[model samples]
Target: MSGAAAAAPVRRLAVIGCGLMGGSFARALRARGLLQQAVGVARSAEARARAVALGVVDEATDDPAAAARGADVVLLAVPVAATEATLRALAPALADDALLMDVGSTKADVVAAARAALDAARLARFVPAHPIAGKEKAGVEHACAELYRGAQVIVTPLPETAADAQRRAQALWEAVGARVRTMTPQAHDAALAAVSHLPHLLAFAAVHALAQQPDGARFLELAGPGFRDFTRIAASDPDVWRDILHANAAEVRAQAAAFRAALDAFEAALAEPARLRLLIDEASRVRRAWAPAGAPPSP
Candidate 1:
């Protein structure tokens, strides 16, 4: 209410967590005139204050239930580990017909948690989602309204999820400039484990391994652009990554094994000078012929 302007319509949106992803969603809603009023919920008083001060939400509270009490759309944006607890806290407050969605990186775990926490009627309105775009940075200060632009957003709905709820969730993401896609919770987890989770793990491992060297600090200081780009995700929130890794352990492990195999093959090629030259030439040709100028080749 404090941040509401004279003519601004209020859509009564509630965002749990108010971190980078949550704050960005709220900001996007307001920027596009999609929400009449937005409220933010976070555990810390400082975060609540920051959200309100930044105008990401008209009101902010530390109580999840209080924020979700009458929200038309509730977005759970907490870390994967905390998502279940947050959903549990808000379950009683969520309206039976209100749309409930999440931006958690993993889908299956969140879907299971929502099933366990919400009542049958409330569960029907839940739509589990993951926005496939983010920065290595964390916190509300890093959130931007345009963060979701041109990004893929996967919406995973169980059989119990209402068709209307799923449609609304997809519409909301599309409204925010995202390309909404549908998948089962299992498929979503498996795909993300390969493209997203595994890459993060590799990046983290690479950085950690490099840091263990005697000249690690000096090496990092002298690192080039390729190293910087490859390792950028290593700076992502540790707690969040830890939860994602554990949530999709099986798929992540499989992807990791595949990556290890590829690395071994590369190493073998390096041991043979002729093969090494062939490898470089083949890689260069394929990369030049197929790769997009600024984007990775789509799978």
Candidate 2:
């Protein structure tokens, strides 16, 4: 933990985006008495007002730079597509010693954004992070202090990252009851593409396929627990998913190709009952042996 993490409260924290991820982070830090002030940036007037009303922030504004002024720490929680723009807008307003972090799902792209927007000093203080936490519900209205409790948070440090910034970022997540891990940006992106991105793509496509059928509505109406469980991620915010899928398009596409090959194998084995049964049995074994870790399946 950094001195600031265990000593006096951090001076101020700026939450950019002020949506579910950003709001929950601010709420958790406030609940833990880790920060003195919370300022939020959002384009929607209603969202800004709601953030203040929900105690997600002490004040809110639409200007990203204004929100970042005097902030000792800043959490960039915007969608991946907006990361560079948000960082560019706030870079000049950040304090000399401010520690910057993010909750973006993709790390490689975010690191690239930071490099493009931040100067040498600001870039050194930037520690790209991804918290494997959230709910099906969206918006600041659903934000709560417990959203990150027992969750997994991954931080990818750049080659020039400052020591204090790294310490402060980890301590902040720890204060909020999250388990933190370290990974290179590229490694983080590749792994998440396989497990997280691939699964989400499959979910969305599966639901889309079903909906395209002639009796789509009736089929959905009669869907059982199995179908509902498999398609749950399809309920994720479409705009958010669109940005994510596009941002990591290459990896997602590769994973999709891999899935197609697996499907082809299954189809080819259909004529041989013994081979089909063996394939199913192998899959069942993998699932049975697997156990999710504390929060993010050991990621």
Per-prediction TM-score to the true structure, in the order listed: 0.91, 0.94
* Candidate 2 accuracy as lDDT: 0.87
For model 2, give the RMSD to the true fold: 2.5
Top lDDT model: 2
Q: Which lDDT tens digits does candidate 1 get at residues 1-299?
A: 11223223337999998899999998887787878889998878898888889888888999989999989899999888887788889888988888998999999899888877888999999999999878899988888998776678889999999998887787778777777788998999999998889999999999999999999999889899899788989999988999999999999999999989877878998879998888678878976886422222342
lDDT of 1: 0.85
Residue 50 in model 2: lDDT: 92
Q: Write the per-residue lDDT of candidate 2 for residues 205-240, one digit (tens) a residue.
A: 898998999999998888898987788788898877
Q: Which stretches of candidate 1 lie over 4 Å from their true place?
A: 1-10, 278-299
Candidate 2 accuracy as TM-score: 0.94
lDDT of 1 at 129: 92
